[model samples]
Target: MDDPRSRILPLLRQGERLLWVGQPDPRVRFTGADALLVPFSILWGGFAAFWEFMVVTTAKEPFFMLWGIPFVLVGL
Candidate 1:
């Protein structure tokens, strides 16, 4: 049987179109871009690692099962 969810799911996942505007300076190059991206990547990566550790280490208990599993899964 054909599922009604097929059409509805596509629309639900579709995001609004966005245009990315670049920096105005022509002199800005790879080093400049790297400098900006590296710190953000490091910070986010550390947070993610710490978060995963908390989730996995705590998952053995009922409290972690009920709360941590879904919170980390969906990202509240």
Candidate 2:
């Protein structure tokens, strides 16, 4: 440990001790999970936006009003 009057002091209150800091593994690698989730999220968002635009412009009847509910919920 260094002197107590160090230039940059840690903000610990009384009766505190530093345990651990920083990532256990700093290395980066592609994973199977990200490969699947990324594509799924993109497709979900695209479909939601397309459905919303169609409902707003081309079709605005009573049935279409209810139809857009699913897209809005998914987009949110």
Stretches off by above 4 angstroms in model 2 are 1-30, 62-66, 72-76
- What would the per-residue lDDT of candidate 1 be over residues 1-74, giving only the tens digit for each residue? 56655535555536843344334788755687788788877776666556667766865666545554444444
C-alpha TM-scores of all predictions: 0.38, 0.47
User: Mind giving the per-residue lDDT tens digits that candidate 2 earns over 1-76?
Assistant: 6554452346777887666554456566657898987787778778877877887788777687677778667645
TM-score of 2: 0.47
- Top candidate (lDDT): 2
Identify the leading candidate in terms of TM-score.
2
Error of 1 at 65 (Å): 9.9
**lDDT, candidate 2, residue 23?**
49
